[model samples]
Target chain A: MDSMMMGAMTQSMKSMPDMAAMDMSVLQACMDACAACEQACTVCSTQMMDCSPACMNCADMAGTMMRSMLRMQGMTAASMMAMLDACIAMCQTCMDECMQHADHSDACRMCAQACKDCMDACMAVKDMMMASA
Target chain B: MDSMMMGAMTQSMKSMPDMAAMDMSVLQACMDACAACEQACTVCSTQMMDCSPACMNCADMAGTMMRSMLRMQGMTAASMMAMLDACIAMCQTCMDECMQHADHSDACRMCAQACKDCMDACMAVKDMMMASA
Candidate 1:
């Protein structure tokens, strides 16, 4: 997210008490991770491997997680946590599935890496929220 | 998704144990609902209301849900259920938030309606899975 968009979002989200104190950098990192993971998974799914379904599911979940972060005004700490947990689970599942073909498929390898990155990013957000709380 | 794409998907997913038995019509309806909800939420987010965040989140979730349905080869019954539950929760939250301003905003009203429809469509898929299981 750009500063201009972030400015607009922050301004619009003044009604949310928790959002006011949220770290934009942490949120932005997670969004970026989600976007990357979604792209990787999309490409991996095209390979028609056994992991294709998991890749597709991860891609969607990651995209949703990114968008949710972008629209933080709609989130409570609890909702955010739940969403993060779900994202992490989906990523982990995808990564596990993709890793099975990592040696045979470059796309699966890359997708697995992306899922790991996304999981780490989501965990970071969860950690930040916990610390803040 | 078109019949051609659906055909391709079904062909590619032949390796999945359960996907062979899945009903395309039920999955297609859910995908359509998800796509509609995503669009409605995207438009609603542009309104910059308090619900914008939730709308954005819902939009992403709905899109992801739709795509997951399209790529059913990667899904297991358990993962599908988890994804559906998360999607339902996100839609319910978005609907609740959007309904608050429905009287003043057509976008919000449409978004809320879309969320409700998506929720119902997802529930139908769940019910179908349960009946089959």
Candidate 2:
């Protein structure tokens, strides 16, 4: 999520016709959100709450979604859309599961917030892609 | 993962009707392969070759795939199959890219092999699911 990595990713994206026109700022925001969600979910998962499994799933999906954006050359627009949808679904599931325990566990509360942010970010990306298309 | 973590994951899966009859050994082997593939791809990604992006993508996908298996309660059979297919495709892309430089780079060679193993493990899981379905 640093400038240097973003610069490298931007450079890489130039080679893909569908990705060349993407707004770097939007992509960066989504990546940052994904990273934050992944970290939050990871911590939440370690708490061994009932939501742990959903947290684990969301964490991994967020991480993968972030990496896929970083490596756009390995993706087509269709594939990217599918991945974003999956990430969004996973985040929603995790957020719903974590919200149940949010009252008693600070970790779940924070994780749920992270999942919400990530879902919103992913949706923004999807919207951008749709508009561009 | 260690036995304790696996035991916990197995206990968790018992609650999911679709996953109740899963063979833990097969799932364990797939998880091990995914872990190894993730590590190898992470190392290979740092090399900054043409395959670096693909390696990063592969590493994340493999990690996600493994975690999804660990948290089967969050996944349905349809979603799991789609994820497995995506992981296998990512691994194939990474393997193809890494194999290009395998002759000169041990990291690429090992990463390529790891990708192959991960792909095979994912396919085995898919086959198991299909057989049971």
Candidate 3:
């Protein structure tokens, strides 16, 4: 997610037809959101609460989402849409679970925020996909 | 992937409709493969080969595919199939690139093997999904 790596990723993504006309910033934001959400969710999952299962699921999904952005070539329009739907579902579930304990846990609060951000970013990608399609 | 964590994950998974009848062994094997392939792909990515992009991509797709399994609440039959296709595409691309230098690098060979195993495991999941569907 550093500037150099981001630059490298952008340079690589320019080759894709659908992405060629899309803004790199949107992709970058989604990736950043994913990384942040993954970290937050990971920390939260270690809490071992009733919400832990959802947290663990969210953490893994966010990590996967981040990596998918990092490797866009392997993603097609359909896969991307499916992934976005999955991520959104995961973030919603995680956020709801985390919110139950967010009042007592800073990690859960931060995780909820990260999940929200990730959901927003994923929605953005979905919108872009729709527009392009 | 620990016994405790795996146990928790397994217990959570048993609640899913399609997964309720699955041989947990098959899912466990697939998860283990995904974890191993993710690690291998992550390490392989740092090598920055012509394969690096594919490595990075495959690693992410594998991670996503694994996490989706973890978050079964968020996945449907179609999403799972799309994910398997993407993971297979990624591993194929990564293995092809890595094989170019497999004669000189153990990591590449190991990576190729991991990719192969992941692909096989993913295909197994796909086959299972088809049968279940």
Candidate 4:
């Protein structure tokens, strides 16, 4: 996300007690990873391989996860954790599916890497939440 | 989604035993509703009202719900149920928030209606799933 949008989101989040002390840089990195994963999975899905369905699932989950973070007012910490878990599961599924064809498909390789990055980023956010809690 | 994309999704889904008896029309209606809701919510969020965060959350959930339907191979019945419930909850939250400003904002009014339609569509899909199960 751009600084302006991030600023706006931060400003909005200040009103939510659960989100008031959020680490902006960590949140930003996770959002960026989700965006990248969404894009990569979207491109990979177009390849129409067996992994397409998983890629589409991952793309959508990543997008929703990113948006939910931006919309902190709409989320409770438990819901946020559930969403993060779902996203991580989707990313893992997509990564495994894409890895099977990575040797032959550049798109799949990139998508798998993106999913890995997104999963790692999501885990970071989860860790931060746990530490704070 | 367009007919061609729907057809492709249908074709891909044929390989999934759990989705073999799925009703295409019901899924299509739900997807269309989700798409409309996503568009409406996206537009409404730009208004920068207190409801903007809820609108954004609803939009993302609607989009993910739609895409997940298109990629049935990636979803188990349990996960699908969970997602539908989440989508319905999000739509309800967004609609409630938007409805509060419906008397003044045309955008909020439209977004609330879109959310309502999306929630109904999601419920219909859930009903179909339960009946089939």
lDDT of 3 by residue, A17-46 (tens): 766766778888898998999898888878
Worst 10 residues of 3 chain A by lDDT: A73-82
TM-score of chain B of each: 0.94, 0.96, 0.89, 0.96
Quote the positional error of residue A114 for candidate 3 in Å. 3.1
Give lDDT per model, in order.
0.84, 0.87, 0.78, 0.87
Considering the two chains of model 2, state its CAPRI-style docking category: acceptable
Fnat for every candidate: 0.54, 0.37, 0.23, 0.37
Q: How close is each model in CA RMSD to the real structure?
A: 3.5, 3.6, 4.7, 3.6
Q: Please list the residue runs of candidate 1 whose C-alpha ends up more than 4 Å from where it truly belongs after superposition.
A: A1-15, A18-29, A42-53, A104-107, A127-133, B1-15
Docking class of 4: acceptable
DockQ of 2: 0.34
Question: 1 or 3, which is superior by DockQ?
Answer: 1
Residue-level lDDT of model 2, residues A7-120, one tens digit each, is 988898888798888899999999999999999999999996588878988888898898788778867676677678778878888898899999999999999999999999
Rank by lDDT (best first): 4, 2, 1, 3
Q: Which candidate has the highest TM-score of all? A: 1
Which stretches in model 2 have alpha-carbon errors above 4 Å?
A: A1-8, A46-48, A71-82, A102-110, A130-133, B1-9, B46-48, B71-79, B102-110, B130-133
What is the fnat value (0 to 1) for candidate 2?
A: 0.37
Worst 10 residues of 1 chain A by lDDT: A12-21
> TM-score for all predictions?
0.78, 0.77, 0.68, 0.77
lDDT of 3: 0.78
Write model 4 residue lDDT over A1-133, tens digit each, in one string: 7899889988978888887888988999999999999999999999965898888898888988887887789776766776777788788888988999999999999999999999999999999999888
